[model samples]
Target: MTAVHYWRCFCGILMREVLRFVHQRERFLSALVRPLLWLFIFGAGFRQVLGVSITPPYETYILYEVYITPGLVAMIQLFNGMQSSLSMVYDREMGSMRTLLVSPLPRWYLLLCRLLAGVAVSIVQVYVFLAIAWAWGIEMPPLGYLAVLPALVVSGLMLGALGLLLSSAIKQLENFAGVMNFVIFPLFFTSTALYPLWRLRDASPLLADICALNPFTHAVELIRFALYLDFNTTALAAVAAATAVFLAAAFYGYDPARGFTRGKQTA
Candidate 1:
């Protein structure tokens, strides 16, 4: 099968998913707007009202906008990660996800490619946000910009696998926004993305513990640690475990016998 390894069937899967979304200009513009609104409009107003104190890996007090930049970036990936999954649910309903499933290749690679492609797309949004942040005077060290790529990819995979698992479970495009409200937002808000876990603990021990348990918290922590050129073992461990779980769940969902589907979509 080494001969086949040279072939990037998965890359083709990646491109297809990109093209599928890119063809819709409205979707593209909407995706861009969601994060900018959160960053520029909402975060700025909140920065005045909100007081984010210094936490671990942070040496001094910083603006709320700067403190939450990583989280905001994470938030974009979290939603964008799900966007394509929403598409997957729609495609499954329209009998399209099945077409990609039946290819004569390893199933895991195909899914990985899809996840990576989504991550790549998420990276694009992050850079766009970074550019906007720069224009707004939210610049960081150039190294942080360079280091954030791997974190973006890893964070994307974690969330993308999450999307895959969710697509299989929800089985419908409707109610996705509800899923975001109930699941994704809770994960983001409760995490150290907005405020550090220690600060949350000071406010409430139980809530802090819950945020500590969240994988997205770890994803944010991972990026936060990486951005500062620091290593967070807990964040790394948490992300690794979460990615494994989501990937396992996703593969199980794609099992043909399990009704995820076995054959290609019939045109």
Candidate 2:
């Protein structure tokens, strides 16, 4: 396809995702509610119990809510990513995916387009969450908002790619719930999302090491640092590498000759 045609296709897919999000007010509300509850209820309850020492991105002591804000942002992206994948599975069942696959555009390009669309939707949700956090007195450097944009995009893509990979492997919507539970809960709970590495280490050194190795941990760290207008080279590198690997796997899984489509047909 020509560059113009490719651009048009990308915009159309993105718009469709956006429109779907708009129509599903419950989805948006649920996404916002999950993190807000974590921030207000859980964070408030933990505020007196958990004491955060001064860290790099933070100049002084911070509240539990402030510390986990980035993680909550990542959580929004994680769920939205899986929701996008769920839509893809539904599309496949309804035969719309076959029509999309038959387009003149390369399959990988089409998949990437869908991934970007999902990321776009997630980012919007993140910003909305941030605004609400701000209203709730969660303060950060003013420029941190601008600096965190790239980190949010990178993190969103990494999580969204994982969803794509899962969707390709899952043949039916019924099976996807189990797969999502298997993937999402582990990735989120094991990461530095809820507690610092030191805290996890205090609990279990082995668990801390596993958390350190998780790409979602790096994604959260990336956002955490960016939220303070700081650079985290290691986190950035880890997330970049994970995104590449996940996207490659998703592309291969969606390839016509790779048995993904054939298996779906037989099923």
Candidate 3:
């Protein structure tokens, strides 16, 4: 395809996702409400007593709300990624995805467009959450807002790829909710999203080790460092690697010959 063809395809897919997001008012509300609840209700209680010790990208101890902000942002992207992929499952079942896949555009490029669209939506949600947090007095450094964009893009892509991989594997839309809960909770809770690795180490070394290995933890750390105008080579490497692996596997799983769609396509 020519450059114009590729550009138009990307825009069409992105616009479709954006419109869908706009019409789904509850989806937007729920995305905001979840993080807000954690920030306001959960954070208020914890901020008083659960002071975080000095961590990298942090010079002094910070309140629980401050410590968890990046994690909450990552949480938004994580949930959005899964939600976007859930739509992929719905579209595949409804035959819309198959229609799109039949287009002349490359399958991987089409999927990449979808992934980028999801990342864009997640970034908007994240910014809105950050705005609310700012109003509530959990402000980050001004430049940090600009600095965190790249981190968000990378983290969003990784999480979105993970969701895409899961979508390719899941056969029924009904089963997706259960699978999301199974995947989302473990990744979020087991990581440094709510608590640091040092604290986890003190409590349970095994859990700490698990957190260290979790890609979600690196996603959070990457955002955390970026939000303070810092770079985290280790976090960046871990997340980028996870993104590549997840995206590759997702492409494989969507392949018609040997992937999850094989039986259905043959029938």
Candidate 4:
């Protein structure tokens, strides 16, 4: 009975997540377009100005669009992860999250279900972005492309869990945009998204170390290696460590005693 109930609850949560994105079709397209614009339009212009070195398997004058594809993919997952969690917070405001929370299943299971849904949706957007990149002359081996699916899933889970943690910590939706703008942009820019770590080292050693410590950097590296069908040990470890930390902190944040839901939870 426990197994039956868990599977059913998982399906329910997944369905709810899919419905939310499906109903807001424009949001998905907008998400895809924003990055593509950055890659095709902005990155193209910046490539001439920004100093970037040739990383392995990229032996010639590579376009910035080609270089940043992995990082851009990471960006999409991270943003979507946060967006999904923000939606969860909105659901709480509208009295829907309480419905899920008060269900017979464990809270962790429900949370995982939601996280998995976010991952599934993220993968779809990622592939769409990849197809666009391919057409734009940004080529990678076909197997390299297929192998990135798991990394994307892991990254989506980690970021989505962080979002869930943030949602649980904040009091209301009003504060989310500030958090998004102030928090997300800094994290993205500081990472190896626009350039490699060595490039940042030349810019400022302090800045380079900060980027090294950033979990998002590791996530970016993880995707970068997977895109090239290479494995980065440091990146895998970092993602794993971040996943553990975020999940723990998020679990604590969601605890009733922590006042995460406060007056928001009818449960």
TM for every model, in the order presented, reads 0.91, 0.97, 0.97, 0.95
How many angstroms is residue 143 displaced in model 4 relative to the true structure, after the best TM-score fit?
A: 0.5
> In candidate 2, what residue range of length 10 has the lowest lDDT sum?
258-267
User: Native-vs-model 4 lDDT?
Assistant: 0.85
- Give the Cα-based TM-score of candidate 1 against the true structure: 0.91
What C-alpha lDDT values do all the predictions have? 0.81, 0.93, 0.94, 0.85
State the lDDT of candidate 2 residue by residue for 1-267, as single tens digits.
689999999999999889999999999999999999999999999999998888777888899999999999999999988999998988998889888898999999999999999999999999999999999999778999999999999999999999999889888999988988898899999999999999899989999999999999999999999999899999999999999999999998898888675655665
Better of 1 and 4 by lDDT: 4
Per-residue CA lDDT of candidate 3, range 69-153, in tens?
9999999999999998999999988989988899999899999999999999999999999999999999899999999999999
| Candidate 4: stretches off by over 4 Å | 57-61, 263-267
lDDT of 2 at 207: 100
Q: Could you tell me which 10 consecutive residues in candidate 1 have the lowest summed lDDT?
A: 258-267
Candidate 1 vs candidate 2, lDDT winner: 2
Candidate ranking under lDDT, highest first, comes to 3, 2, 4, 1
lDDT of 4 by residue, 161-211 (tens): 888888887778998999899768988999998888888998899999999
User: Which candidate wins on lDDT?
Assistant: 3
